[model samples]
Target chain A: MSDIDVAMARALLLARRGPSSDPNPRVGCVVLDDAGEVVGEGWHEGAGSPHAEVAALARAGTAAHGGTAVVTLEPCGHTGRTGPCTAALITAGVARVVFARPDANPDAAGGAQRLRAAGIHVSQIEDLGLRTEADALVARWQQAQDLGRPVVTWKFASTLDGRGAAADGTSQWITGAPARQDVHDLRADADTILVGTGTAWTDDPRLTVRDRRGADRPQQPRRAVMGLRGLRPGSVLERTGATVLDTRCPHEALRRLWALGSRHVWLEGGATLAAVFWQARLVDHVVAYVAPAFLGLGAPAVADLGIGSIDAIARLRLDDVTRLGDDLRLMLTPTPDPTEGA
Target chain B: MSDIDVAMARALLLARRGPSSDPNPRVGCVVLDDAGEVVGEGWHEGAGSPHAEVAALARAGTAAHGGTAVVTLEPCGHTGRTGPCTAALITAGVARVVFARPDANPDAAGGAQRLRAAGIHVSQIEDLGLRTEADALVARWQQAQDLGRPVVTWKFASTLDGRGAAADGTSQWITGAPARQDVHDLRADADTILVGTGTAWTDDPRLTVRDRRGADRPQQPRRAVMGLRGLRPGSVLERTGATVLDTRCPHEALRRLWALGSRHVWLEGGATLAAVFWQARLVDHVVAYVAPAFLGLGAPAVADLGIGSIDAIARLRLDDVTRLGDDLRLMLTPTPDPTEGA
Candidate 1:
């Protein structure tokens, strides 16, 4: 592989070490000396921290002069929480720069143009036939920017026959321990965990991410309950501070979540809430935990979404399948409607 | 590997070429000369055909003197269609023999004892530290012998939400093309395909195995309709010569099928019929084709089976998982209850 390919791969690895739930993109930078010897490396910790380029330049010090910097994303030219990365690179006397992805945020654009005007050579990582590996690291943030709303991932656990609860509505444990732990990981990565008032009142879920040993994680997603129904006094959700969005409309609840700066929302809603989101075509992703058991009678996992025939059935493309203990975790995405865009 | 291991592997391969739906076990045999060279090979075609040992001995002719016979099953000592295989082996001057599985049928066993009584050296294939590879070839037959009835495999196709049909009862296609073709192959391997009058009248299914190109296979399984309700006159099942069991009890239906010599029964019954069998614990195996689509409102793939609480839910052990185009084929078996047997 070429030097650019090796450096880009290392940069991508470093980018993933950053906090996932942060609104800012994860970026990593590597500064190579003129002779291509080792120098310095740094990754953005989170928002309000120094950018990757500035951190790497500080670590390089005098060695950064006439050195080349390879980064996972374009160096920002506009100042936000910190100063412009392009100005830091110029002051560090970097001779050449390579970046994997262009800045898609309007406020962060024009970084490459600024660097070139400063008499430094700048080239795209694609020029060397190296694809960006950091796209998934910032996919949710970028999608939120594109849609102007939090990217919704609807998650549910049910038996293999799709029963969410028994006849008496006792749904405490549908899946095994490992599948439940996997959902905790998903919750830890999201900025918000959402449920409906029915779920909050009936199930009284704590709506918090917990470790394998049942201890609460240091970083917890904001919990939100949607629907107009009033929650019971001293419910688990009320006991543990949760935002209550008083709205029956899925779009309105999502808009409220977006206003709260929630980039990715883990929707742990009940059947009715899920059906509404599905009918509104607002669910961006689906995570299903299927237990290897059969409950021949129970509440269905999903309610009616207005589909009355086979032709109108909602189809999804299976993206990933993982065996979690005695259960199966399937990740899927909705197949785009061909007639809608036209 | 030893000489016996090599010969036994080849014998197992030959055994699989026999018809799967036959009542008789598939057996293969290989004759080896004193110099350890294979002189003859043969496999049982089906019932009413020459046994594998006789066929191989016929081909070996004069070369069988003082030779070894490696077989997938013990040579039958008591015969119905032909003479005992032990007599033929002893008459042919076979000096030694090695067999994989001992004959389990009471009426046809004792081949090893008979051979030893005739002063011929007989040993088991396990003595060579090799596993019997032909067990699956005759598993259905052996299971039927043990249970005193046909082994039941309930097959169903449904959407991801466990819906077998839309709200209006339109259930033409739930799974993709590949999964449907797989069901046909299963039907070809079974001795009988069974349904209830509900399915017979509503769906009007032909209940015939067909190839991928929609041509009917030559060896079609016997079709049976089991329910108290009589099928409509000139319905597809009645016109196609399906047997009417006229029973609502799962046990009685199975007893009737056993008397008809149906060793493996593939049940393609509707939801209500499936629930009754499930409640009676008559389902031995399950084959579920899960399509990657969702019908939020519809008839559940399974109806109430008296399961009211999570503790009463029926649990199954996942045996195998296979992807069939846009669907998944899951093979599962019921977990035996510990309390009932004791």
Candidate 2:
């Protein structure tokens, strides 16, 4: 097999890893013989498991000796879940290593450096397509590592006129069933569903993942209630099992959630809470669902972010625009302002 | 010629009409001989001009006899600025009449019916593609004829948070230059720009079409001020050409504008005025420009539209969504409520 064949094999092995990898990057490895024939293949299943290279080396046995290791991500040089993959490759007597994307995690980065120092031929795959594909698989984990907290995704559904509810506070349904199902799909990707105490207590929502037919999902995200306000004993969130954090500060709540192993936080808080996170520049992503209907007067999707003038207004980089039923779903990320000294 | 060939020829002839053909539907015509050879072609130049079919017939002369007349729109039976196109085709001894779109204007729609009654072979082109193209060319005029009033397109530019102005009314430029330039292009298509007394007296905007370089357009729309408030001395609109209407009712103002030969009206009024037109269902279309900025506290793009509940909220059919600079422009048309007995 050629280099292209090895890269294709690595990509296939990477995709074999299911959507269960969290906190750690999803990586795949393939051991190739001297003639570039794939001998063994393995992928990182989840956290607290053997790294891809180590798993592949164990399967390859003596066949891994003098073999080239083709991987989606750079093998880790540090010990976290299992031993460092670099040491494992070296112990297995691998002759060469070819990886797609460079590991951005500071702790796990120096794998190529270690391999080269050990006289193993190490090459970073320069294919832009393969690198982009590998990077996207670990984008959320990389974001969490860079921010030192769970990546926050604020999801909101509102009327086309920007109203979250009617004048009389009737907001039982703003988006259609399709958009609601999309929200559930979004929640499935997150490990934690966060809401302010005001929402948890006032709306008393059961923040549980459910399908369009109202059937509970097999994998459910933990419900988290932030802010100083306390939840009532018989509240829906309290009864449905929620972690109550008595802090109004967004950073503190995010720190606690990160400590609880949450890599992605889905924020379903009210407008005021969203504004607080937005003003603090803690929101990583924004997902807005705009219904075709117009309620001229009602609660706004975002309120009072301390923006007084045009220059102070926040800007977001639009990523995707999709239509679901009669509603539009906009995916955006906050554009970092250079003036803010980020 | 084949129907496809004639349809394509008619489309090209329609495209020959200049952009200044306002207050009237642009139309094109072609005459084909018995041997499928093109005899003559013509397009409506502007308002007060001879209809396309008449001009084509005059050019064809005796060649039009026993030939087929192919037109973008069903030839008119009622005369406006010139003689009826139906009478011209009959006098020219045309054997068959084939048109792309049926004339929606009640006053001019009886041409096909009369041609059929005269024992002439008449057929409406059933090609959906050609009909759609022809209908789009005269969409606003057809809408005006259907509603018995000038087509109202409410265009408003706002911050991404749906604010028209800051709390202190400092909204000089919410969107960037590109979006503002796009708005001027939109204004150039309308014959009149309507605003309420509040907007006229407060903002005092010079409602004129200008290019990005601030050069005035050759054709400027009439700035119309509705409502009873008197304009201050030396107001911008008063100094620039403007028409003052005492009635605040959107329907009455539209009717008066229609009688003045205005076919399309761009409403640049304030939120209250916009709500009035929206609630009355007088707004035929909406052009919203959402800037990627946030003004936490400010005037909303629209205010209290007499809707208290979610079910009563107005629904608009979205037509186009485009990004102009950092602004998102949404083009929507008001969907008539069946309950209102359209």
Candidate 3:
């Protein structure tokens, strides 16, 4: 617990950053109590949960002995449906755990080396998993194991002089409508929310995820479409609940859609598939929605990402930095996936 | 030339908006003498000289009697490359003509009813062509002829509160290297310069247009690629002075791209082909280059043309702003075409 109670249990592992399965990252867990308060807080909401340290040690029962649990990765120790958050922090008697970064999944990198070989008193916090809304849940699985595919995070909603619409794509009431229904809870946990084909032919978008419960109670996600084809004859990507992908070879169409399962992908545009998956390192995490308004030129704050200078870029690495409504959310992690283009 | 000098030539033809085909919409044309300063001052720049009213009635050749030409758009009466600018402002006797906007086409819209059926003396200047920066070259060719394509006027430079790089992709010295070598003179009249596949897998780009005395230059627009099949092999779209389209239907993949000719197209991107041509409205125009600094949230400020709200926004309209070096440019015009989908 100390490192500020696992940095407030890694900011409650980002209430599943918009939802889950999203390249599966966002994670938060609390627990505290040596009178420091915050007895239990959970997170890791989708993919069938109980995890986030078994929902904060089942709400920290037995007052979790000497208190302290925190967690934000580095606490899995093998398992699929449950068990082993370092053996549920040694049967919840938890003398000390702390944790923050360190979890590039060799299957939970050995949960703090098996809680220091059972001696407990763990403690780790290396980069307290930076806070861009609690590190877009582990930079969306560390950019899906460094780009095998399924890990694109682009959340933009600008204005503080970043212009998104005023030159004439009208830009709908700039960022109001209650922050565009909070990006549909950030695309309901994104497994797919893409946007292109000229933003669905000038915004004919049904990218789903409603909130005021209007448009027949939306909140869908999985609406994609990248482009090259014309798309009009029956439109909305031929309707019937979407999934269009066609920006030809978009990282081999997202690695054959992550081997036909798709863990988490949400690129959603502003500069063409966010510069085609941040120049195909297949973007790992980024949730921007900056909206204020000036439009000095009118359009372009991010067009063309085929980068021609700075020797072409892609070593990113940051990790987290959050803010939401007036929007902001930088969570990067590149460095280790140039494998020369694949 | 008299109905108040054709109303100040329709207020100097609403100012001088375009054969925006490439930089040359310089239309000027003064001609005041009775107490006013210069007897004349023409301007136009390219494609058939003598435009700005036969270069201000051939520099007011015969100071041409009663003087007063003003002008901007309404002076042509027909003839392919020369002659008839309302018959050289009725043989340069230029008594009065004013002007500013009235050339919407149909063979140069009757030039103020043929300069009031040659009775000369015309007036005008109404919305002064909506007022300013050379009427965006007649709203960028009336938005590429009411949206058949060629309109995306975006310019980009970044930093002033808008950030184009920093959060890891670094953004190569921000906007130096002499404003990135003045965007190759804005890609030499740009007829094409797009990017996707996350800018060819995180910067393996080669959109070309460099120059220092033509450094391997092939000047004058041409270099596109939106979904460029799956290149992992020697990346950079396999190289060789590119021209790939890899169809998926960007409105019939742009009719096999006018059989390899060219007419103007720069959809440029990062947010999935700017959200697939900003939702297939095909971007028509938006040239932003803010520059001052902020990179805050992850990456991408203009990456999704796959539009979402404001009913698929394609009609932007602004036209021309300015600044340049520290960054600004602006100049949009799409108001039509773009029915819907991404």
Top model by DockQ, which number?
1
- Better candidate number, 1 or 3, judged by DockQ: 1
What lDDT score is found at residue B158 in candidate 2?
A: 74
TM-score of chain A, cand. 3:
0.34
Rank candidates by DockQ, best first.
Answer: 1, 2, 3
Q: A1-342, model 1: which lDDT tens digit per residue? A: 678778888888888777665667789899988888658888888767888888888888989899899998988877443236899888999999999888878888888888898899998886434443666667888888898888899998888888999887777688999999999988887888989999898888898999999999877889999988967789988877799999989889988888776888899879899888888889999999988788888998878878888877788998888889988888999887533565
What DockQ, between 0 and 1, does each candidate earn?
0.72, 0.61, 0.05
**Candidate 2 — which residues are off by over 4 angstroms?**
A1-21, A30-42, A56-69, A79-83, A93-96, A116-121, A211-213, A338-342, B1-24, B30-47, B53-70, B79-83, B86-98, B104-128, B336-342
Candidate 1 residues lying further than 4 Å off, grouped into runs, are A1-14, A30-42, A55-68, A78-83, A125-131, A338-342, B1-7, B31-42, B47-50, B55-68, B78-83, B105-107, B126-130, B338-342
Against the correct fold, how does model 3 do in TM-score? 0.29
lDDT (tens digit, per residue) of candidate 1 on B1-342: 889889999988888776665567778899998788999888888767888888888999989889999988888877443245888899988899999888878878888888898888998876433343667777887888888888889999988898999988887788889999999998887889999999998888899999999999877889999998887898988877799999899999989988776888998978888888888888899999988788888999978878788876778888888899988998999887533565
TM-score leader: 1
Model 2 C-alpha lDDT versus the unseen true structure = 0.80
RMSD in order of candidates:
3.3, 4.0, 24.1
Q: Cα deviation in Å at residue A104, candidate 3?
A: 18
Model 1, position B265: C-alpha lDDT score: 91
Q: TM-score of chain A, model 2?
A: 0.86
Going through the candidates in order, state the TM-score of chain A alone for each one.
0.88, 0.86, 0.34
Q: What residue runs in model 3 are displaced by over 4 Å at the alpha carbon?
A: A1-156, A160-182, A190-283, A290-292, A295-342, B1-73, B76-156, B159-172, B175-287, B290-342
